[model samples]
Target chain A: MKTDWKFILQIFLSFLKIGPATFGGGYAMIPMIEREVVDKKKWIRNKDVTEIFAIAESVPGAIAINSATFIGYRLAGVRGAVAAMVGVLLPTFIIVVILSMLFLIVKDNPHIESAFIAIRATIVALIVYAAYKIGMTAVYDKTTLGIATVTTAILFFLHVHPVVVIISGIFTGMVAVQIKSWFGMSIKLEKDELNVVKKEKQVKEA
Target chain B: MDVLVELFLTFLMIGFVSFGGGYAMIPVIEIEVSNHGWMTTQEFTDVIAIAGMSPGPIATNSAIFVGYKTAELPGAIVSALAMVIPSLLIILIIATFFFRFNENKFVKSAFYGLRPIITGLIVYAAIKFAITNNVIGELSWHTASLMIIFGLSLFSLIKLRLHPLFVIALSGFVGMVLY
Candidate 1:
């Protein structure tokens, strides 16, 4: 594929807008990403976002970065992927670097330290909230809930590395489906995407 | 240069292994960062918090932070690049080999289990952060306050249904004011 700079730049600019606009990280940028990618830019189909979420989440890294790369690659080959990746990361990089630098200067200040003290506590709540929100959709059945419970126990109690946990999850998911099939049950994977993933906040891949 | 290479390799390892969003990488990151004497557990929490409050992914944000601490702007730049390199390579390989593996039954079934495990991974991250940050280790006035804030944040997100951005922003405000 010939590297088209113009389209690559467009992809970059599109995600540049998305990077700094998102907050609270994780899947928080899904709706905004959809707006830039599928709705406004017309770069991809509506349903592809769900598939992208699965692929991005199944592998290592952030959903935001993974989807950016995946969509970028889909749009304009490797150039497109690079454009989108840089686009998405550039704004956040600049902002975070500035923040981190500023934090270095003020981290030990009594006031800011106190603020971080509380902020840290609230962050725990935020992560837990993420779990709760995603769990609502993910653990819809006993099998799924069982997977979640066992996984949680292992990660928490054993302090197992998350990569290992993720691998186990994939294995368990496949096995769970196979076991169900033994009893003549089948997993309807894609038919229900619209209902579960169509919403803004609920479509999180985290 | 030595430190930069270390930073690159360390985060490269993290980027490759991370799954279920950057939150799941917390434990892995903590160990690596501490082992390298980059930061203490307490300091890493600060990185996690900033990463959370910022836009983009936590893994990327952490890379930036660690990079900055090591070598300023250039260090930050390299670390950021290093963080995404593994995923970039993986995706490129996927694009080459399985351009459209989304419809594969084996993959779909794997995700069936993965979705909930991600949920669990995230929950584990939260609990670990709480313990590391001293929010849950010992119960006292400080822990009590932390619990109250945690409850309020949860309520705002779940019941009141506030957006995460607002919840985090509000938490920062309350943190500055109360704590």
Candidate 2:
């Protein structure tokens, strides 16, 4: 894609604004990013945004950063990617430095302590809200919902490690699919097999 | 030899190993911060709160905040970059290769298997935060029953398409008034 510095600059500034102002994390920034990228700038379509989200989640990076890199690359190129990444990160870098300096100067203040207590409590609620939003989109099917519910129960009640729970969920999902196949009710494999047969028939006819 | 380089390397290791992001990085961060005499446990917890509430990913923000505390602007830059580099490299590799094998059943199965695991991780994070932060610890009947309210708020959020910020603000108001 050809570089569009004007569009790239606008996207960069938008992400910079979002990076500092947003609380919680990547999930918290979604609605605002949607407003800017999808509604205002029209840089990408809503469906593309959703697909990018899925791709971002499946990959290793911060979802927001990954999305920015992809969108920036698509709009411009490598330079755009660098611009967007720096934009998203710079505000956070500056703010954290300032906050740390201030904290050093007033670490023992009573008012600061109480304010943090309040903020911490509020943050718990915010994290819950973020999880709830992500869950709504990610858990679409009944099977997925069941997995989510069971996993949540295990983690909440049993105090399983988060890594362990994630690993187990992966195992459980695979086993569930295998069991469904054994019961002659697996739609996924059947669809794949049907596609193979159709492709073979077309080849023979040609 | 230099404290800045040491801090940078430490955060780089943290970024490489800390899977699932945010809350998942907490324990590793606690170990490094306390081990290096960089900050106290209380300070670490406070930084986590600020990072969570301020913006961006918790791990990256924490690296920046803690690094700055330990050294200066250079420390902050190196730490933040260190925290981000591993994940960025991995994502780029995956993005390049994923589509080529998108339709492969084994790959599909692996990812399908991973869905529940991710859910479990999130659930585990929520519970740990609740306990560590005293959100649901030794509660009275009134406070204990607040789970029901949380549940309803979440339900309304999904079904009614309400913005999460509003829900968070409302919960904060309720906490301020009631708690």
DockQ of each: 0.65, 0.38
Which stretches of model 1 miss by more than 4 angstroms? Answer: A26-28, A37-59, A183-206
Clashing residue pairs for model 1: none
RMSD of 2: 8.3
lDDT of 1: 0.80
Query: Candidate 1 at residue A149, lDDT?
Result: 85
- Show the lowest summed lDDT stretch of 10 residues, model 1 chain B: B19-28
Model 1: per-residue lDDT, tens digit, B1-179? 49988988888888877765676677678778888999987888888777776787887898899889878998899889988988899899887786566567897787788888888888777877888877786778888888888889888888998876677678777888987
- Report the lDDT of model 2 for residue B73: 82
lDDT of 2 by residue, B72-107 (tens): 888888888888776566655655554633345654
Query: How displaced is residue B162 in candidate 1, in Å?
Result: 2.5
Which candidate number has the best TM-score?
1
In model 2, the Cα lDDT at residue B46 comes to 69
- Residue A28 CA displacement from its true place in model 2, Å: 4.5
True contacts kept of 1: 0.81
**Model 2 over residues A1-206: C-alpha lDDT tens digits?**
55667877876887787777776666566566667778888988876766665555555546677667666655666556666777878887777777678877875666565454444444445456555544544465667777777777776677555545555654665677788788997444222222222333346448
Task: Kindly report the docking quality category of candidate 2.
Answer: acceptable
